[model samples]
Structures are given as structure tokens and as C-alpha cells.
Target: MTRIESKLQRLSQIEATLVDHPEGITRAELARRFNVHRSTILRNLADLTIPVYEEGDRIFIDRESYLINLRLNIHEIIFIHLAGRLMTSNIDRQNPHAASTLRKLSTAIQGLAPQISQFVKGSANTFDNGSKKQDPHYMQVLEVLTSGWARNQKIHLWYHSQETGPIKEYIFSPFFIEVGAFGQTIYVIGRLDPDGTYRTFKIDRVERIELLTEKYAIPEDFNPDDLLNNAWGIWFTNQEPVTIELHFSWRVAQRVKETLWHPTQRLILQEDGSIIWQGEIAEPREMVPWIRGWGADVEVLQPESLREEIKNETIRFMNLYGIFAGSKENEK
Candidate 1:
């Protein structure tokens, strides 16, 4: 047999032994069982994700780390079910780990409350297109990124960036992984080596990635909450925060006031049932799409630039829908 096949068979044997013996077999015992040296056993275990605990001279696998029971309440179980359903859109449909996680949660909940399980089944039928069918290549990159993050290792990536106008090679010290809403792409948060600053990169845009031997230590001051405190979305900026005020018509005022949109958001209700919403943001670009989503029901009140842009957007919409002809008034 080839060396690769021998290694694969050894790894499979080690995993099976570890699973059967939760108390764990020692390094010497493992080496003896596999008919290999202690150094060879260590080498084989390096790539595995299993947690090892050393008590005296005996090294054993900590099974409790992988086998956890949260003992979730009904509401929490339902939330997990919904989140797992949503995650199906981001991850590949054939992803066994994600499928097993959802199935285990469903089974646990079904045993406790069969009625809720029935409701979940009925609700799941409504979302036939929930699985967005992610690219297998993207999934492979994500796996490497996750492993790099867990190991705190540096990764060399050939990334396609429009800003640089080339497929540039970068060494990144990845610290976090951000998965956006359902169907949205995944992003990697890392500190670029030469620049020594945090930047977010889309996972799918990475053309190539190679995990390096060097490891990195995350900064103590790295706080994602503080970094994204004033920004409207993912693009965190250090520029001065701008105050934005919007007036929502009475028709959509209640809907607008129902959710807390930002950390600095304030809402004032007028006597006519309209709402004056105000917030401070670092980047207005992210809010543009959300503002346009309201259409004629909302109007930007402060920040003349945003107001003008919204007016221009409305004019463009009118031109497309044939509401305004190619007339001088519409042009003005």
C-alpha cells in the first residue's frame, strides 16, 4: 500500500479507538497499538481536531468537549432549528456536519415535544428554496480558513481585488469569520501582514490559499464590537460619525419604529403618527440600499448629500417606470 493509504488507515484506527475509549488511550499505548513510534503517533495527531488532555504522563482524548448537551428549552430548540435551516442556505447542501447538527437538534426536540416537531416540519415545507446551493470551491476555501483561524496560523492567499486591479498575493493573520444573513456570502476578518491593519475579505474572491508554518497571536485590543460601533454595516471606519435623520410617513412609521436599527438610533413619534428617526453612522454607503428599500414611504431629513442622492434615485426610478418622460421638468 502507498504511504498515504497507510497514514489514512492509521488515522481511522486512532479515531475509532479514541471514540470507543472515552477515558482515552495513552500515547505509548497508541504507538504500541498502531505498531509505530511515539514520534510517528504525534505526527499523525497534529492534523486532527481532537482535544488532548495530559494527566501525569498519560495523554488522553477529552470526549466531553465534543459531546456536549446544552439541555435547551423548547423555545431555544426552535430557534436552533430555524438558525440551522437558515445556515443550510450559506453552507453546501451536502455538508454532512451541518446536516448532522440539524438532525440531532430536530431529534432531541421531537422526543420532548412531538407537536413542535410537527410545526417545524410544516414550516420547513414552506422554504423549499432555503438551500441556496453554495459552490463547492468556496466551501473548500472556507474549510481552510476555519482551520487557520482555529490554529492562529498565517495563510498566504492569492485574492482578486478590484481596488488593486490585480490578483495580489497577501499574508493574512485571520482572527474571525463572519457569516452574513441567509444567502449572503461569508467574509474573513484578518490583519494583513505588510499593512498590519484589519481588513474584511470575501471568501469566494480568494483564488488560492496556502497555510503557512508561522503562527500569529491576536491583539489584546481587538474588539469587533468597538470596531463596528459607529459604522452602518460591515465597512468599519475611523472617520467622524455623521448624524442622519429620516422622516417616515404615517403609513410605515410604526413598522419603522418597531425595530432598533442601530446602536445610536433614536425615534420620535409625531402627533400625526409619523416617525422622525435619527442615528449616527460612519459609512453612509451601506445605508443607501436600506433607505431605497422604503421607496416613497420614507424621506431623508438631514445630511443634504443623502437627501439629494435619494432624490436622484427617485428620478431615476421614475424614468425607468415611465412616470416621468424625457421632459425639462423631470430633468430639473
Candidate 2:
């Protein structure tokens, strides 16, 4: 079943179990019933508004809250389920319990409709392929960031820096987490304490993080999207945004025009069915791989520096693949 379907189903199951066994369910029993670890069950319930309490050792979801239904129809529930699935699809890598959460929800609402259950089960099966295991340390860091953000607290981080050759310490006031539009990499954007200068840090690069009691107020004028006004991808430079122009042959014109390569991109259709793709970018190096992907069909038209860089890279590629340039041709 898809993650959302699984979550809904699991939630429905939990409600039914709680309702049936009104006295309470022990953590071990619940974990065994759900086929998840005790800790996973705890994490799954951490953010939920469900009233849970412990009597001696058994934990119980408040009967009062469980009896209060949302009165949602199957179609409405399915729409919400689909929305949750899309959200999970984007952040599944970062969120450890994303699948389990959806599973719980799916189980809770399974009997609402047989057709819905079948669809949810099918989707869950399709997306159930094994995913990459997350680093335990990374998960710890994520927890610290999440907690700090929720409480408006600051964080002290010991982050590994490859360029700097050592771990660096910084006091960061995390304003928000940013994920790639296509959901590639995740980032934490915040201001360095004391300096108050904004910076973006890769979540994976964080070696260790500690949540501090010191509170911080996010700048009222802060805007995350503006930070990427000139970025081609994730790497941002302080250099002035340069106008980049590319001419694509008619063969790839439609393909080029269809994609929004950058936020500042503009496409000009030529009479010959070719396309002139133009955009402003802060870092030209980031665009190298993309430009090279089109092979000989795309040509850099402006920003002499970028054009030269591409030309140099092409020559390097030709030299690397001597079959195309001829190894002995240089000697001749």
C-alpha cells in the first residue's frame, strides 16, 4: 500500500483497537500489533493531537477524543489521503516515520469504503520498495533543529566543512527548512547568532547539534524564496546575477521551452523553430552539467565567462574521450 494508505489504515486500526479495548493498550502490545518498534510508535504519536495517557504502564487514547469524528466522506478522506501522500513523497527521505504515519491513518479509515481500501493497498504495494537507510546521527540533528524551531530556541552546531578542512561551530537561529521544488536536497536556512547574517546549511553536513534554551525571533522581513532569485540550483554566490543566454536547435526547442530551468528564465522563439533560452544566474558553474547534457544542440550565447567555461569543458571532454577527437591528431 502507498504510505498514506498505510497510515490511514493504521490509524483506523488503532482507533478500533482502542475503542474495543477501552481499558488501555500497553506500548509493547501496540508495537506488536502494529509490527513497529516501541520507539517508532512513540514518534508516530508525538505530533498527533490524539489525547494519550498512561495508567500504570498501559497507554490509552482518550475515549472522548476518539468518539469525536470529523464526519468526512470517503471521497473527502481520499482527497486528504492523496494530499498527504504527495507531501510524504517529497519528504519521505527526511521523515523516518512518514510511511508508518500514513499506514496508521489508512488503517483507521479502511472500513469506510472497500474500494478505497483496495486502491490504498495497491498504491502502498507499488511504493513499498526499500529506501535508503538514514544516518542515525542525521536523524538526531534533525530532531534538534525541529525542536528548536518549534520553541523559537537557538541551536549550537558542530558542522563538518570539507572546504574548511575541519568541523566548525556556529550558533544558528533556524527560521525555516527548505526543500528543493523537485524534492532533491533539504536545507536549513537561518541566521548566525550574534552576526545575524543569513546563511543556508545542508542538513547532512551537520555533525552534531544541541538545542539551546536561548530564544530567537525570526526576522519579520525574512523571505526564503528571494534567496533563490538568482540561484540556478542550491549553490548561491554573492556575485552579481549575470544574464545567461542559450540557443537550442529546433530539435530540442520545445523541450527547452517546456522546462523552467531557472526562476528568471525567459524563452524567445526564433523563426527557424529554434529557442533562445535566457536566464539570470548567480553561479555559472552550476549550469555546466545541464548545458553539457544537450550536447552539440545547445550553444551558449552570452556571458563571455560562461561561454569560455563551457568551451573549456567541451575541450576537456573531447580530450578525455580521445575516440571522438583522435588521440594522435594532437601530435600531428
Candidate 3:
């Protein structure tokens, strides 16, 4: 490895060791463990961002003060492993921070959960291998936005909106960062300057970002969970929540009832062995694609507008597939 790469690796190891051993390890022991000189260990320790203190000949990091020092039980570790696996599988882009997090988690639980640690390590390796290249500006934009959020500072960024078909500039104060449950797309919810109107911006659409000196505070009434309480996904609308009722054919009733699809979901078993599913959400448009995925097995039972929309969409699909409406082929 190059000298810089070696140094960075050593620094990471030193931090991990300190975190793992709250009682601390001697500088001499650290040098021996890594096969480096004592001076090199000291220099590397100084480069660490975590707060570390020397107690006699030993150096220690206070677990309470360390943000990454997690004490998880075996079950919790498994949960984290599964979540990380799902995240890595869904996000097909190179994210150095995510890889680093997986590596650190692997190191933290290697002794207690060796099998899970191996899987986590393998996931990190996949990211490091760069199987897919991310947008060139993604990392930079994410870092700037994260910094701005942490410091309560405003940010100026150039954003490209697919819906509006233009590149617009906004001065924003970030309130929260959220990932869409369905698509795994990361978004920032915040307020725009001057008008102070709340908006959500997708991170990938950010072309450039700059941290501004101006600072702002999140509103007292601004609760992210409350904002998304009735949302189907990341979309929030001022329209009143609507009750959505869907009927599932008996063929898919068992599969439909296997999981809780939403917080407000209620399932009613029918005498015919089919299922009736109902839920309340602010925006019905966000659920259209999921509704379509069920094809003929599911039908929208309420909201005539939404039912008509689905009927129209199905007609379009039929036409696209060279099948005419009211065709005998569909009956067969």
C-alpha cells in the first residue's frame, strides 16, 4: 500500500482499538500490535477525531463521548446486519461513508458475531470494489448538506428538477434527511430562503452546493414524523387524508396478509376467502405504482377518481400490449 493509504488504515485501526478497549491500551502496546514505531502511533492518534486522553502510559477513549461506540446485543447486531445487507443491496452506487460504516460495524461485532461480521465485511468490500459508479457530485453534495445540517447553517445549492425541467438555485435550511421507503432515494426536507416555504429536494438532483455562514433553527412545530405521518412515502401534501380501500383476490389473499403494509392498514377477511385492505394516506398518487403491481389480483374499491385512474391505466396497458378492450383474450 502507499504511505498515505497505510497511514489512514493505521489511524482507523487505532481508533477502533481505543473504542473496543475503553480501559485503554498503552502506546507501546499499540505500536507492537500494529508493528509500527511508538512515535508513529502517537502521531496517528493525534490525527483521530474522537476525543482520546492519555492515562499514564495508556491512551483511552470515553465510550459515552464517542459517537460510534455502540453496545449492541446479539439480536441487535443481527438486526443491524440485516438492515445493512438490505441497504447495500438496494443502493447500487459507490458510497465510501456507507462502506466505512459497515467496516467499523464489522470490527465492533467480530468477536460476538463472527458470521454476521463476515457478511458485513463482504458488503463493504463490494462497495470498495466500485461495482457501480455514483454521480460525480453526489458525495460532495451530501457532505456539504450534512455539515450544514449539523452546524445549523444555511446552504446555497444548484438543483436540477426533473418535474420542472430547469436548474434552479435555492438557499435552504435543512430540517431533516430522509430515505424513501420504496426507492431508497435520499431526500432533504427544509425551508427555502425569503419565502421560508418548506420543500423536499432529492440529493441526487443536487448539481452543486456551498455552505453559507448564515445559521437557522428548525421550527418548534417541525416534526419530521408528524410531517410524514399520513404520507405514502416521502411525499407530503396539504390535502386531507383519504381512505384507500382495496380488494384482493383469493389467490393472493394469503400473500397480502403476510405483512403489515402501512401504519393505518386494516385487513378484513371476506366470506369468499378474498381480503379487503384499507388505509388512510395523504397522497394517493404515490401508491399508484404499487397498486398497479398487483395487476388483476387487486382492485381499488373506494375513491371513484382513483378507481377511474387505475381503470384508465389498465386500458392503456391493454392497448400497448396489442389487446383490445372487451377482448375474448382477456376473458380466457
lDDT of 1 by residue, 134-168 (tens): 35677678878877886677999989965456898
Model 1 residue 279 lDDT score: 95
Structure candidate 1, residue pairs in collision: none
RMSD values, in order shown: 8.8, 11.7, 9.7
In candidate 1, which residue ranges exceed 4 Å CA deviation?
Answer: 1-71, 85-96, 117-131, 162-165, 181-183, 325-332
Output the TM-score of candidate 3: 0.77
lDDT (Cα atoms) of all candidates against the true structure: 0.77, 0.74, 0.85
Candidate with best lDDT: 3
Per-candidate TM equals: 0.72, 0.66, 0.77
Ranking by TM-score: 3, 1, 2
Could you tally the backbone clashes for each prediction?
0, 28, 0
- Residue 53's C-alpha lDDT in candidate 2? 77
